[model samples]
Target: MYSLLQRLRSLRHGFWYGVSRRIRWSRGAFEEAPARELCNVDPEPAERIAALRDRYQVQFELGMSAATSRNNYEYLDLLDRGWSSLGIGRPSGGVLCDIGCASFWYAATLQAFFQPDRLLGVEVEGHRLFRDGRARIDYAAGYLWRLPNAEFVVADYTRCLLPADLITCWFAFLTPAAILAWRLPLSLLAPERLFPRIRHNLRPVGLFFMVNHGPAEAALAEGLCAAAGLRRAGRWSSPAALSRYRMLPSVLSWWRAG
Candidate 1:
C-alpha cells in the first residue's frame, strides 16, 4: 500500500511538470522582425550593406526600439549626412565610442562611415524588461564576434569609463515607470549623470553626438550640453522627406570639448 501511494505521488508530480512545461510564462526573448520592414535604405553599393550585415548581423531590427524614427536604415543615412555636415571625420584616424550601443548597430555604421582607428561600444544589458538578460548577453557577444574592428563592454554607461574621440547617444533614456506615473526626465539619464565621466573620457577636441527622441528631450540635451561645458557644433532635426520618421522629435546635436 505504501509503495502504491508513493508511485501515485510521483505520477502526479510528473503530470503537473508536463503541464507546466507546456505553458510558457516567461516574457521569453526579443523578437526579430524583417529589417526591410523597419527602414528605408537608399541604394548603396551591394558590397557596402552586404559587408555591414555580414559583420554585425544587423538585419531584422536596428536597435532597442522599432517605434517611430528610433530604428531604421534612414537613421544611418541621416547619421552619414549629419556627419558630413558636421565634418566629424576630418583629418582622419580617431577613436569612436558609442554609449548604450545595445546591439552595436550604430557602432558598425560609424565604423563603416568614418573608418575610425578604434571602435568601442558600452552597454548595460537587461536594462529593459522586454528581453531576458541572457539574451542580451548573447546578442552583445555576437556583435563583438562579427565585428572584428569593434569592441563592446557590458557595463552601465553612468559608471563605465572609456575614452573616445567621438561619443554618441541614440534614443538612450530612462525606462518609464507604470502608466500611472510619469516618464523619468532626460536630465536624470546617463547623458547628464555621466557628463563628468564623458568629459574625462573624451580626448581634447573630442565630440559628443546626442540624438533625442523628440523636441522635449532636445531641450534637455541642450541643458546637458551646457552642464558638461561642451560647445555646440550644430543641430539637425528629422528631415521632411522621412514621413514616418518625422512623427518623432529626432534632434541630432553635436558638441565639442574645449
Candidate 2:
C-alpha cells in the first residue's frame, strides 16, 4: 500500500511538471525587467550590516523593495559568516557556479562578495517563469542580460560541463521526503550520485560550499560528501538568528577537492 501511494503521488506530480514546463517554454523569454521584490521580511540590524562591511570589505545597495533589501543583507551576512568560519578568503578571480539556484535571486550579492571573473547559476528547471511584480520574467535571462560577467544555464548539475573554482549549493534535496515536499519527482533525489559529480566538476583544490536546512540534513550531506572523497574544511552554525522565519537554523559547511 505504501509503494502504491508513492507511485500515485509521483504520477500526479510528473503530470503537473510536464504541463508547467510546456507552458513556460511556450511563453518564451520576456524582456529583462527590473528584478522582482522578494516577500516582506524585517531588515537586518544596522550594527550587523556595519560588521559585515568591515569584515568582508563589501558594500550593499538598496534593493528594489524592502524585502529585497532585507534579503540582500541576510545573504551577505550568511556568506560573510560562512567564509570566515571556514577560514577561507575571498577569491581573486575564478569561475563560480551556484547549483540548484531556483531563480538565481542572489546573483548580484554573489558577484559582489566573490568578485569572480565569471559566475554561473545552473538550475535543472531553467524555464521556470517568475512574476517579478511588474511582469512575468525568466529569472536566468534577466540576470544574464543585466550582469555582464554572469551566465545562467538550464541543465542538470550532475552533467554540468564547465569546471568551477568555487561552487555553492543551498539546501540540496537529499531525501525522498524533501523532494516530495517541493513537489519534485522522487526520482530526482540522487544525493549518492550528486556529490561525486560536484567533486568531479571542481578544479583541483576548488571549494564546495553548501548550506543545509538543519542538523539532520547537515549530517546527511556531510556524510555524502565524505563518501565522495571531498575533504571537510570547516562547518559553522550562526549563534544568533539571521532571518525572521521560524524554520530550523541553516548549517554551513565547506569542502575542498584534493
Candidate 3:
C-alpha cells in the first residue's frame, strides 16, 4: 500500500511538470517577419547602407556628464573669487582641440562654458553623433584632415598637428597615475615620447588641460609636463558625480603652462 501511494504522488508531479513545459513551448514558438515586407530598402542606397551596418554598432563612453560641467562651473566660480590674485580673465574665442573626444558632450560644454570660436574634436571612432552639418558646434566627422585653424587627430595620438591656444586631452588621454606607481616604465616613457610633438603645437603660453581618470594619473601628468618645461597654470579638483551615478566617470584636468 505504501509503494502504490508513492507511485501515485510521482505521477501527479510529472503530469503538472509536463503541462507547464508545453505552455512555455507554446508561448516561445515565434516566426520572424518576411524580409521583403518587414524591410523598406531600395537597390542602390540600401546596399551601401548595409555595408555600413557593421560600422554603425560601435560605442565608447568616456564617463563625462553635465555634472562635470557643473563641477567645472563651480571651480570657475571659486576662481572668480581670486581672478585678481591669479590675474586671470575669462577664456575667449580661442581655437580649442579635444583629442580623444568621445561622444562630444564635453566639447559642446566647452563652447558653452568658455565661448571659444572654433572647437575641433577628433576621435578614432565614427563621428555619427557630432558629424551632422547642422550641429551648432563646427564638427568634421570621419576624418583627421589637417585644418590651418586647429587640428585634432584620432589615430595613435603621437603625431603632431597645428598649434593651439589651448588643448584639452581629457581622462582618456592621461593614464592613471596609480598605474605608474605600480609600473614605472610606462610612467617614464610614454609622456616623454608624446610631449615634444604636443609641445611643438602650442603657443608661448598655451594652456594644456590634461584630465586623468585617476588621481595617480594627475600626478603623472604634472611630473611629465614639468619635465617637458610645461609649467602649471592652475590646479584644482571637484567632487564628481561619477562616484555616485554608476555610468559616469571622473578625471582631474592638469592645466599646463597657460
Best by lDDT: 2
Pairs of colliding residues, candidate 1: 214-249
Write the candidate numbers in order of decreasing lDDT. 2, 1, 3
Preferred candidate (lDDT higher): 1 or 2: 2
Clashes of each: 1, 0, 2
- Give candidate 1 misplaced runs (Cα > 4 Å): 1-72, 87-92, 126-134, 174-191, 240-246
Worst 10 residues of 3 by lDDT: 25-34
Tens digits of per-residue lDDT for model 3, 188-247: 225565665566676666777665554666776677777776777766555432233323
lDDT of 2 by residue, 80-193 (tens): 777776666866579999998876767777887898999998877665444442212364454455579988777778876779999999889987777777776776778988
- TM per candidate comes to 0.64, 0.83, 0.49
Instruction: Give the distance in Å from residue 214's predicted Cα in candidate 2 to where it truly belongs.
Output: 1.0
Prediction 2 TM-score vs. true:
0.83
Pairs that collide in candidate 2 are none
Off by over 4 Å in 3: 1-87, 125-153, 173-189, 240-243, 246-258
lDDT of each: 0.58, 0.74, 0.45
Candidate 3 total steric clashes? 2
> Candidate 1 has what TM-score?
0.64
- Among residues 3 or more apart in sequence or in different chains, the pairs in candidate 3 whose N, CA or C atoms overlap within 3 Å are 177-216, 177-217
